[model samples]
Target: MLSKRVVSCFDVRDGKLVKSVKFVNTKEIGEVVGRARQYYEDGLDELVMYDITASSDHRDIMLETVEAVASEIFIPFSVGGGIRSVEDATDLRWAGAEKINVNTAAVDRPELISEISHAVGAQSTILSIDVLRVPGGPLPSGFEIVTHGGRTHTGIDAIEWAREGERRGAGEIVVNSIDADGTCDGYDVELTRTVVDAVGIPVIASGGAGKPEHLYDVLTEGGADAALVASMVHYGEYTVSELKQYLHERGVKVRMHY
Candidate 1:
């Protein structure tokens, strides 16, 4: 059986780790490298870092920060934001990222997905989709894709976009709910299930992971391959070991050690 992964997300702004509620009211968490090493030591399955402002500001990813974090973690480390070309992805890979995530740039040029996958192989390419619930719209899934740190709402249907991403050589997709982000309520299981059913690739459900039960719900009922966690792990609410032990006792398959 495939293990359900618990991924820790670092939303970095100005090279410092930060957190936000619905992508607003951002506040610094601390120096990123130390926090990353701490999480790695805590037995996290994987780690993802995002230059939250890179795309909106139209700048390249912070390679220094990426390298810094990558040096400390032994597991898969994925980085995204402001990756506009194949060269950028290559640079990140060289800097130690095991996976390259493409968001706004992929939306702008869908072929960039193919290009990166072709260059690095699909297994190393991840499509990160930020989705918002748009009720009463022409969208079939009632979810719309948002970009540039949830600052721009692209009217594209979430399900169709996920399908397109898979067809274009994206090996994995991270479905993050803009509405559920930082709310600590739960994941948008409906949104996650919609994409999971629409594509053949593995889907990582992101946003709104409050407690262990929420993770269980998304991984089992929602049919997600993994659950991305932030606030719950970030604010001393739970450690990676504690969360894994909770899920393991409840029959959710997860790696139990660092």
Candidate 2:
């Protein structure tokens, strides 16, 4: 069986780690590199760093910050935001990101997904789908895709978009639930399951991981390959090791130690 992964997520704005509820009222958590290094030492399975405002500001990723965080970790690291072209993705790869996440840019130009995947291989490209729930419209699921740091709502169906992203060559999809974001209620299993069932690539459930059970549900019932944790882990309520142990005791497969 494939061992489930526990991913640590950091949302950086102006090079500082911050937390938001429903994608607003942001507050700084700490220095990005320091927090990332701490997570690495605490035995996180992987780390995902996002320049939250890059696309909104129409700028490139913070390579300086990326390099700083990458130098302090020994595990697979992925970075996203403001990746507009193959050249941008290449710069991030050279800066130490094993994978590149494309959201806004890919949404604007779907071909960029294929182009980046072709240049860096599909395994190095990830589709970060930040979505929010909406009333029934074009999508039967009523979940629309949001972009530009959850500020722009694209009338794209989450399920159909996931399938298209897979076809376009996104190696993995991180389905973030804007509705449950930072609420600490739990993951949106239905939202996650929708994408998981629609796509062949690995899906990582993001937004609203409050406890170990939440992670377990997403990985098992939701059919997700991994869970992206933020507030729960960010505020020191639980460590990655403890959460993994909790899941392991409950019969979930996970990496126990470095």
Candidate 3:
């Protein structure tokens, strides 16, 4: 297995880094560029910048913020939110992002995933899946795939969509649990495992990461290649370096700077 990576995420809104629980009640945390630079210098394997409110607000990602953050970071960077077409992904790549993450757009049109992947290579395309358990009783015949920043449900099975994404050429998939997001109760292991088993490509588990031990659990127990973290780091609860050290001590192979 590849060494587990510490991936840092910066949820941006109106050009500033923000943090929230379950994608609501956002609070501005820091400057996007500053946070990106700090994480890069701290030896994070990759950086993800998400415009959390763009889709819900119907606005494009802030190009200036993307340019600013991209200029400061050297590692692979992904920018997502409100990207609905091949043109949008191209523009983000031109602005210096290494990859483009699509959530609402991909769910709306699965064909776009293949088109974008063909246009920019699969390595530059990432499909971000936002999932939640069907309330009450047994899960329905299909897994629930939510969209529009988790405000709307697509009624599509996430597992089927992930498999379709791989068939269409998505290089990577990010499984984000809406219920577990910002809650930090540890990742929804069952949910992540389901997606990972269904897809052939790499899967980055997002949401519900509150502690270093959680990272260890996701990598070893949950079968995630990498984990996306937001709240803990955004609120200064822990640093990426510290998290890597903790993971390393727990027998998980994580990239460390110190």
On lDDT, the leading prediction is 1
- For residues 1-258, write the lDDT of model 1, one tens digit per residue: 778999999888877888978767889878899988998888888888887764444234377788888878899989887788999899889888889999989988899999999999999999999998999999988999998557898899988999999999999999999888878999999889988999999999998999889999999989999999998988989998898999999999998856
Q: Which ranges of candidate 3 are over 4 A from the true structure?
A: 53-61, 135-142
Q: For every model shown, what is its TM-score relative to the native structure? A: 0.94, 0.93, 0.92
Question: Model 3's lDDT to the true fold?
Answer: 0.83
Q: Flag regions of model 2 displaced more than 4 Å.
A: 53-61, 149-151
Question: Candidate 3's residue-wise lDDT over 30-85, tens digit each?
Answer: 88888888888887899988876645442444677888887887889898887888
Q: Candidate 1 local accuracy as lDDT? A: 0.89
Error of 2 at 96 (Å): 0.3
Candidate 2 per-residue lDDT over residues 1-258, each given as its tens digit: 678999989888877898867667888888898888888887788889877763454334378788888888989989987788999899889989999999888889999999999999999999988888997577788999897556788888877888888999999999999888887989999999988888889999999899889999999999999999998988999988889989899999998767
RMSD of each: 1.9, 2.0, 2.3
Q: Please report, as a residue range, the 10-residue window in candidate 1 with the lowest summed lDDT.
A: 53-62
Q: What are the lDDT figures for the candidates, one per model?
A: 0.89, 0.87, 0.83
1 or 3, greater by TM-score: 1
Clashing pairs in model 3, backbone N/Cα/C closer than 3 A: none
- Model 3 lowest lDDT segment of ten: 52-61
lDDT of candidate 1 at residue 208, scale 0 to 100: 90
